[model samples]
Target chain A: MPYFAQLYNFACWLIGDRVAAEDLVQETMLKALRGFSSYQQGTNFRAWIYRILRNTFLTSQTGLKATASLDSEDDALPEPATLETPESILLVRHEQSAIRSALESLPIDFREVILLSDVEEMSYQEISQALGVPMGTVMSRLSRARKAMRGLLTAASEGVKR
Target chain B: MTCDTWRERLDAYIDDSFPPEELNQLEEHLRVCPSCAAEALHRLKLKHATKAAAAARFAPSSEFRSRIAQGMPSRRKRLFGDLWIPGLAVAAAILIALAGSSVWEWHAQRQQALAELVDLHVTTLASVNPVDVISTDRHTVKPWFQGKLPFSFNLPELENSPFRLLGGKLVYFNHAPGAQLLCASGKHQISVFILQGDWKFALSGTFPASAREKGFNIESTRSADLRILLVSDANPGDIHELAELLKAAQQP
Candidate 1:
């Protein structure tokens, strides 16, 4: 019950369907209850449960399709310094809707890392455990995700002005 | 620091992963570099804005929560829901083949009750005020439960043992009033439930039959009308040792 709302929020974004997200959260709860016995004490229970949800999502039909859609174009990132400009101070201040759209438009892997880090406010260690990735991967994914998000917001703001 | 070096570590700087010395250097650089300053401000604003958007965007409806609660396996109305049955004879035949489904049903129900008790134990562990009386001495914990229950049970001496008497509380287990003695062995919190009821649920034996149920190793025993269940996440062997200690300390 404590993390239900947050779990549902993550589910909605991960699956991108309201009805399916609800079902996914329910399935996750059932699975967690069944496997609660295996959960060790003094470990990050939140990360443990999130890991189960991630594994469940990765195995679902939508998850498989989402995986296939992982674009390789952005794998080669420009130096982060190149993106630093004074214009970003104003560009990043777009409306909440703009931010949401930018977040939704990113690739699922990047979007997930951002959600787990910024929204859920999980530690890099927890994110690593939840995503089954190394801590370095979490940081790099977050860095790239934010960069891509900045580009999307800038483009959206430009479109709105024109 | 060069602009490139400062830029590369900017994300980690914002994340507070840098040591105090490196953070001071980054701060000094940010003060001197206009572009880097603007970038840091933008990232800070973006972080706040994204957190706000996420908080507002995808809240699950109240209906969603109710749907989940209804569908939870533990709260289902029946084990098998609305299966078509040809006749009572067929049902009877199936029950016979399953070695009397009523006994199996009873066992399932008992396990469910144990699961609820385990939930109660964990909840107690999670709560700040786990017990009514707080004391490390058995003398204090034993007397505290005097009027709390309709019955009384002896408390074991926890001295010179790994387990310490933390406290005791009054609780209801399966609608029957019971005294819950809270204990701690090393780092593990243990709940010993003393209820005034028949041992309707079988717990194997009085010699510390340690079996894991609902994430806790439960060591249960019965002496006359008193039924005691010790619940802990500690290893089963340690719990068994505690059980033996309890049996030896019980008054004759």
Candidate 2:
């Protein structure tokens, strides 16, 4: 019950539908409840459920497409601009709705990392558990996601010139 | 540490994931290096903005909460339960494990404050009579809290906007009495809470920082000695617009 809301929100963001997210969360909870014995004592409960939720999504209709795109151009990504520049300083406006579009436009892998790291404030280790990947992968994905986001937001703000 | 090395550790430093030994070393380095400090500030702002951008996330309705809650077994360990019949309690347990076992102390405290605020919002929603004072007029709503709270606040004129003032009630946040005004845009209800600014340090950094509690979007900012929070499942822009109005109302 404590983190029920966070799970539902994460599900909604991933599934992009309130109704589907609700079903997915129920299914995740039910699956966990049934698989309780399988849950190792030391495994993070939060990350374990998040992994189950993602696995559930992958098997579901909408998240199936996410798996296909998972291997999309990790190395082909453009090098991101650093925060050291004066021009980049002005691009960091929190109120820019363009940021939402920029975030939405990112690849699913990048978007998920951004959501887990930034929005949900999960640590690298926790995100690794949620993603079932090494900690290094989490770091790289987060780095690339921010870089990609910076690229998109910079372009967006320039277009609007606000 | 070299700036390049510091730059690599910047995200970890900003995220507060690096070890305490490295944390102090990094802070010492930042103290002498203006360039690194500016870069750190810039990186922190981007992180803030990215998090702020995600304020548009969907909030689950109370019905969903109830449905899931009721679906789970009330008191069973469910350790050996059949996999086909699942329950909601297990999921809740996992999500609550979100509390990083080793995270900084302040992070837990801030999360607690955000959780409390969310709980207060949820409690209000479930109540039969949500508001103590019932009136849409800003003039009436503003006066209702006159000595009930330690401080006073202004309510925006929602004259031609899509928003309508529903009413307000007195709330106790962190054991401090305050005012919570209910408003609506379209079908979503928004709770605008004005509380004594005792925990200002919890929400450090910029005035208007955003946080998530459950699935709700919360935009909180400080005005004078009062802290204003707007919570709703409404879109981020709508919540922000209402937040701006509240801030403007406080201004001359």
Candidate 3:
């Protein structure tokens, strides 16, 4: 159940639509079950499952439009205030929302690398295997993705100052 | 190293991809360069922020789960039904046409041949005897293929390449007798089946293009009238390589 929730969350982040993400995750789970006989146990099940989720999201016809809309809407949103006072819970929520919005604005490949590397804390080798790329490609993508994400956050922070 | 060099190395340093000496130099450069230090700090902070944002997880509604689960099997069954029903019907009609003459006996023989092909496929899969040679070595496997079939079937050395030979088994496909070679690259498995004879069968509008099937990726190509079907879980690019290798192996 915990695994499902984690996968569901990652799916939601990837697709940016809760309903569709859930459907993708469930489909991934079903695939994993059917192909379980072929699965090599004691390996990284999480990466295996995440790879399925990513593929499912990529192939979904409805996903393209939903992700586009989400990306646009996220870009239009304002950054959240970073005030740390206990009474400023709403401000924190706003900030978190803004951060999520910024994340959603990144390109799908960049966003995926960032999510897998930073968010999921997967190693470059694992990320490469899951994404079916070489280790060098994984490292380069992660570097580029982090640079892009940092630029976005910095811009958001600068926007608040302005 | 300059700050620019250190900046580029920063991510690798964090990933620990750098050697110990290079990493030490990177750390030393970061300590001395304020701009690089600030960049590293910003990167670290962003990493944490992104991690926190992703940790804000959400679950899919129960209704959505039920809907997807219900949809997949029906889709698969429908595909299988569409392919096999017409196939069975066509076989039945061919039998009816041949029932009255000596040609009917020939037709019966053809029908029997087709049935035997399907039976061969089922038996190979069912008995776990999918491969005659069970080594990853191309030399060993290729020799096992020698003197086994009438024509020379060249087995490429794919174990050194991306496609590691899993094993080879004799199976029937398209109502023709053939050899099925199973190979894997990483976690993806590819089943390459080579059959005898010169029949060119188009699978269009029959098996959903093999691309639509969720877990399996398949590609079929022919050489010297020998049909090869390569199916795998790898992406199309990698699978196509297998096809090209098979085609190359067939050459002088």
Show how many residue pairs clash in every candidate, following the order shown.
Answer: 0, 1, 2
Question: For residues A1-162, could you state the per-residue lDDT of candidate 3 as single tens digits?
Answer: 336766877788776766556556656654454333333577677766676566556545544443343332123333223222221221244557656766787767677888888777888877865664457667876776665555566566565656
Per-residue CA lDDT of candidate 2, range B1-252, in tens?
A: 589888777888778787887688989999999989987887787788767767446677877676666665434232222223434444544454454333223443455456446545654554444576788899999998898777888888998888999899876554457888889899999899998776644345433378765578899887777788888889889999998889889986
**Candidates' DockQ values?**
0.16, 0.14, 0.20
The fnat score for candidate 1 comes to: 0.31
Off by over 4 Å in 3: A63-95, B16-18, B60-217, B220-252
Task: Give stretches of model 2 more than 4 Å off.
Answer: A70-96, B72-252
DockQ ranking, best first: 3, 1, 2
> Candidate 1: TM-score?
0.55
Q: TM-score of every model?
A: 0.55, 0.52, 0.54
| Residue pairs with backbone atoms closer than 3 Å in model 2 (clashes) | A30-B86
Candidate achieving higher TM-score, 1 or 2? 1
Model 1 residue B137 lDDT? 82
Per model, how much of the real contact set is kept? 0.31, 0.34, 0.29
Residues B95-213, model 3: lDDT tens digits: 55445444443433433333223323333333223466798877777677676565668877675587788787544343234677778867876777787646423322122223423
lDDT of 2 at B21: 75
